[model samples]
Target: MLALLPLVILAATPIVLLLTISTERRHALTAGLALTGLVGALLALPTAAAQAPRDVTVLLRVDASGLAYAALAIVAAACLVVIGYRYVGAREANPEEYYVLLLIATAGIVAMAFSTHFVSFYLGLEILSVSLYGLMAYFRRDRWGTEAGMKYLVLASASAAFLLFGMALIYAELGTMTFAGLVAASPEQMSNAVVLLGLAMLCASIGFKLSIVPFHYWTPDIYDGAPASVVAFASTAGKLGVFAVIVRYFLLPVGAVTSGLTTYLVVTAVASMLVGNLLALLQTNLKRLLAYSSIAHMGYIAVAFLAHGPVAAETVTFYVLGYTLASIAVFGVIAVLSTEPGRTSDLDHIADYKGLLRTRPVLGAVLIAGLLSFAGIPLTAGFLGKVYVVLAGAQDGHWFVLLALALSSVAGAWYYLRVVVAVCSTPDGESALERPSVPAAPTAVLAVLAVAVLILGTYPAPVLAVIESLHR
Candidate 1:
């Protein structure tokens, strides 16, 4: 029962918020309730993991990996909710309901993190997709928001079709919906043409959710259209949840039985790295730049995915945590910069950041630190992440992908440094932008994220030990 606690708490959060909707302090009350629910979920993690590898149901598996990713998803969601308080409160007529949607989305995320069966995975994916559709279009008055939402809906529905067809094909061939059943099959059964095709389709659909290249067309537009806080949740919590399932699937015994699948992953990883970074260099918009960078980062994680060894899971976990911290920090700055209601976000133009160091030094420093981490500079969490990726690639002797990763990071550094330079540049005149009054809560959250990055980069042994223990 303790193993079920996190999911129970997450599922109940929206209802708890809905019940308090009539309260006079509804906005503050809603945020507080949502945060409390996330804290409760985090608190339940140790108990959940202590009884390691428990099957909660046919659909859910409570295990170390699930527990770890659940913690990451919930933490990322909590950070976004904190940052979104001002953004949602100002423009939303029914502001309290926004927390309801967020918590509900997080519930889907948690489900995906713990899912062990195809049925559970599809349900969780649809739940997350549906919730995000509403959150993206929350600011319906904006044309960009409306258009982004529609585009995502159409593409996401098509992706779901691919996934379902793939699942159907696999079931027809193997007559199994569970990973254990599939892995138990003989290698000859696993290598059927239909099964391979089905696996390809599944990979494609998952690739779309992770925003890797070729399936990543919707990312920049969606990121640009959505609120910064929501983007933070989508990039970190949403992607990490999907990756959790992939991690489990790859760790299965049958994973090594498919050479064709391994080759397909390698090609896609290289394509994502090259394309994602090249496209990012041409972007002047900060949101779009980060969106493209995320694609490359996903590809980098793929290297670890392809490496079969004891450390593969830990490497992915470390890289993801580093990326999560950097993304949260970057989007936190964007949320703070976006103070106006019923207007475009303030993070759109590169020029907007000029003289930011002089006007908002704290945010300026945070933004630079976050960007540096993203660029894989030493003394930041991202550098450690890249080192692990390199180790994984070398372990697998994947020289081509390793070279691609190196070149992509160089490309990434160029664009990231451009932003840092702009931030330090002098304003042409008295900066026309009004410095938005900084909220203590969001500011404090950003500070914590920045400090976490530094600490993780400086001394990763503690967290690495924990990840090794969990996956061991």
Candidate 2:
């Protein structure tokens, strides 16, 4: 029962908040409940970890890796909540409900971390997806939010259908929905055409959630349209939950699923790297650029698969932590620096931030650090993440993926540096941008995140140790 504390807290927080919202509406009260729940969930992780590597009713698994990943997602969500508190409160008439949706979404993410069955996986994805529908369009006045929400609704519904059908087919062929059942399958079951097609369908739906290539049409629009606070979670936590499922699902022995799955993933990874970078070069919108940047980063993370055993899971998990930290820092900057007064949307163009460095040193510095991290510059966590990914790829002789990573890194740096140069540049004639009276809480959170990026880059042993223990 102690093993379920994290999920219980995550689920219970929202229900309590829902009751509070129904009776009395208070932004501070709502955010307080949400944060308390998340922090409690974080504190409870050690309890869950104490019973590490235990299976709960064949649907959920309590283990070190799941706990760690859940912790990462919770951390990211908590950071967003801290920053988002002011943004959502100031913009919306009824801000309390926003936190409700966010907490519910966090619960869904936690569910994914613990899930060991397709039933749980699908349920968790829906919970997250349904919450996102409201979150993406939370602002009543923003047309882009409305459009983004509609597109997501239509696409998400289709993806859910794909997921269901795939699950049915896989269950039909394998006679089970659990990982252990799949692992125990005969060679004939592995090679069944129905099984491969079902796996392909599953990948198709999963690809949409991760926003990888060929299924990534919704990313830029959603990123641009959704409030920065939500975008931060959608881009990072959302992907973390889905990728956790993928890693667990694809823990197949070599040649168990044949070549098609590899071909699908590799093609999308390479495409995501090249196409994401190439398109980002043409965008002047900061959110859109970051959207493409995420696609490329996902490609780099995908290269972890070329490695065998726990190496792949560890690499992916580490990269996720690094990416989430750096991204939250960057998006936190956006929520404060780029937003117009009375606006919840953060669709600011690159040109709008002409002299961020000269004006707001703290925000400017964090922005630079985040952009550099994305570019894989030395002395930042992103650089270390890329190195581990390269080693993982090399261990399996996946030179092509490495080449793509190298090429994409160069391309990514070009654009990321362009933003950095802009931030570092002095705007002509008119004095540099005057610092607005930004909220202190968000700024403090962002500063901490920036410091964390550098700290992790310099000293990753702690995280590496955790990952090692998971596989031990």
Off by over 4 Å in 1: 22-25, 254-257
| Candidate 1 lDDT trough over 10 residues, lowest sum | 249-258
lDDT of 1 by residue, 157-206 (tens): 97798889999988999998787777777778878889888888888888
lDDT of 2 by residue, 1-472 (tens): 8998998999899999999889998889989989998999999999998987789998999877678779988898899889988778767888888888888898898899888888998899999999999998988987898888888887788788888999899999888988667667777887898987887888888878888898889889888888888888888887777877766755545444446666776788898999999999999999999999998988887787767567887788778888999999998888776444675567368876777887888888999999999999998999999999999889968788789878988999999999999888887566425645777888899999999999989998987897777654
TM-score of each: 0.97, 0.96
Instruction: Give Cα distance to truth, residue 392, candidate 2, Å.
Output: 1.2
